[model samples]
Target: EAGVVQSPRYKIIEKKQPVAFWCNPISGHNTLYWYLQNLGQGPELLIRYENEEAVDDSQLPKDRFSAERLKGVDSTLKIQPAELGDSAVYLCASSLGAGGETQYFGPGTRLLVL
Candidate 1:
């Protein structure tokens, strides 16, 4: 089976500029998530989607960040007016989210905000 896909494995941008990343989750999976992981820390979930519903998004920085999982398949995360501290790896994961299973993570998109 195919795995999750992400783009711009690496990125460098000036602070206060806008940036965006994309993700494609695995087939047959009903749950998708977007997470931000610092250089030396574990992933912190930004959003969780079950199909087209955003079941959780409490950790997202709404002031300058936004995300969406459309059609319950693909997802996109955007940062407006990025800041130096926004530099981190954006990880995407998917799972059945029903019977308790491990989440499969993608390679991730690393952002370097200047």
Candidate 2:
């Protein structure tokens, strides 16, 4: 019955550094997602996982960003050589399934690249 959990709520690093974010979705939830939000934009889906399979990841920047869901439970997102333009809020969300279910979101990790 616990909600999603994320670590290192805030992170700051210089450009070209690597930064990672972690997320643990709610129990029993089968669908997990990673999103990115810029200063004034709505969250954009970066990747989506149905259990251990990545169902959607077209928006993810393969050059410097990568993600994985372990055993269909926890997930991690990484950005290597992060660019200054990458400063934004990274959100993690989960739901019971892909259809009709209400998704729950975590507090999110704020990354600042200087």
Q: Which residue pairs come into collision in candidate 1?
A: none
Best by TM-score: 2
Q: After superposition on all CA atoms, how large is the RMSD of candidate 1?
A: 1.0
Query: Model 2 over residues 65-85: C-alpha lDDT tens digits?
Result: 999997999999999989999
TM-score for each candidate, following the candidate numbering: 0.95, 0.97
lDDT of 2 at 58: 99
lDDT on C-alpha atoms for all candidate structures: 0.91, 0.96
Off by over 4 Å in 1: none
Clashes per model (N, Cα, C within 3 A): 0, 0
Q: Model 1 clash tally?
A: 0
Residue 33 in candidate 1, Cα distance off native in Å: 0.6
Give the residue spans of candidate 2 off by over 4 A: none
In the range 21-102, model 1's lDDT, one tens digit per residue, is 9989899889999999998899999999999898888999899998888788998999998999999999999997845777
10 Cα displacement, candidate 1 (Å): 0.9
